[model samples]
Target: MTDKRIIKSSKVLVTGGAGFIGSNLVDRLLEQGNQVVCLDNFATGKRENLDLALQNKNFTLVEGDIRNYEDCVRAVKGCDYVLHQAALGSVPRSIKDPITSTDVNIGGFVKMLFAAKEEGVKRFVYAASSSTYGDSTNMPKVEDIIGNPLSPYAITKYANEVYAQNFTDTYGIETIGLRYFNVFGRRQDPNGAYAAVIPKFVMQLMAHESPIINGDGTFSRDFTYIENVIQANQLAAIVSYDNIKELQVGSKSVFNVAYGERTDLNQLFNILKKNLSEFDYKISDVNVIYGENRAGDIPHSLANIDKGKNILGYNPEYCIQRGLEEACKWYWENL
Candidate 1:
């Protein structure tokens, strides 16, 4: 991270600000003395995520949908930077309802990008996904290397990168995309059909119930912590345009935002159980159940974070073990 955090004392707009990641970013921005506006419709976001932010004088909540251009324009009003975190996430959800996912992830993305351009924001940083790696057999995924998108959710994220680059080329808007790998942390929702594995497993184990693995437990991911993601967003918001153009592949910059390490599902399960068992003795005795692999699931995932470190001065502070310790502690105390 840079000594001079560039986004300080500025007006910033965080789309999907009521969600887990968005709300955390909002709180960080507000704490740094930035006037922050959060845009969310509560479709997947929880209002309680903004409880602390709402109490802060620097925070404003815009109850609106990104699918609506007018709502997008209103949210971008007078903001210097736009962190576009809004999207319909989850592979199974997209597989079941590709149309709605397309409307929200693709259509909503275009509206937010155009709104930033129209508002003349200094920069636009967005939440990209590791799912863009798709069916690639690459050991450590790089920014330029990719394979066919396995799910509609992956396609939408790739489309976001494409549109962001095009906007930079055609409209002269500065954009940066952070391809996040399996981000987990505080405030992540634990109850839902589309809940992420970490939080879902935490809740089940809290109740002394068995947590099920989606496969034979060989699948792996480069589980990144949320604080590292926040660091990447700040760096992307601040890095000079000249520096970005030098690394530009298609008029914009994209980097893999990860901890640069992989953990298998079996290892993840054991860690979670061990961490949560501190709260309840029975949790230590709980066992895991294995089922068929999920649709659109990848066998392994890892990232090469050299691009971010070399260009943006990004040094991730938390590894998987440290991150899981923090996340598990939060779930036990708060949820």
Candidate 2:
């Protein structure tokens, strides 16, 4: 990991800093007393998410798009590290418009990489996705084994891993890719058609509305919390630049950031129902309505976080139930 001392002293640029995970990372980095510059175009990222960070003197928000090389350059200048969190997310959204998704996720990622490279950013960490494990049907997905992408969103993220390797091999720039699995927590938008399941369900229960399960409720995922993701980013940014070279040269070169366990929709529903019941007893009676399965969703997704554990010294502090309980409290007050 880059030295903790160096990370604290560093000025890091977080692309997509107004989005769910990015905004949370900005909060944590600012808490650590690091100068954080957030670059976002307010596409998927909401301005309200950065409210508290905006009040911090050390925080800077650049309203920009990564797809534009000049915007990428503006965001990268004078930064010690670059955390690439900006991307067009959601499988259904990508399916609706693959071209736009490709332009943002893949095209924008390359632009930021090049910008960081030119600016001599010490380390580059990006948000990779578990969807890249596409169609593999593998339980407890390991980093090395991956299958053909099932959606345009998956294709873009897989391309990111390949490109990160090439960037490291060809340009000698240090890069780290964290393949996130079902991340959720505070500031996670639950309103959109492409909202994440946990927050979406929480908001539904808050309104006493029935949440529709996309299948028989057997589909499962390793629902990681936002804090764990923030921890992974901090660790990724703190690695010694030399260690990054060794990792890029040696291992599978990508790490899965997750809870290393899976929870099916039925279990998730039960967990949310149980926790939210503390606020309203009627929530306990909210029935789930099952529907047709999503076209591109995997039956189950579990991450083998051995790489993150052994390499990054990561031990996720929140399990599913704990994360759910905390998220429930946040949604109860905020939603």
Clashing pairs in 2: 1-238, 1-239, 1-240, 2-238, 2-239, 2-240
The residue ranges of model 2 lying beyond 4 angstroms of the native Cα positions read: 1-6, 241-251
Per-residue CA lDDT of candidate 1, range 18-128, in tens? 998999999989988899999999999999999999999888899999999999999999999999999999999999999999999999999999999999999999999
Q: Scored by CA lDDT, what does every candidate get?
A: 0.93, 0.89
Off by over 4 Å in 1: 1-6, 248-252
Q: Tell me the deviation in Å of residue 264 in model 1.
A: 0.4
Model 1 clash tally? Answer: 0
Question: Which has the greatest lDDT?
Answer: 1
Worst 10 residues of 2 by lDDT: 243-252
- TM of each candidate vs. truth: 0.98, 0.96
lDDT of 1 at 122: 96
Give the total clashing residue pairs for model 2.
6
Error of 1 at 117 (Å): 0.3
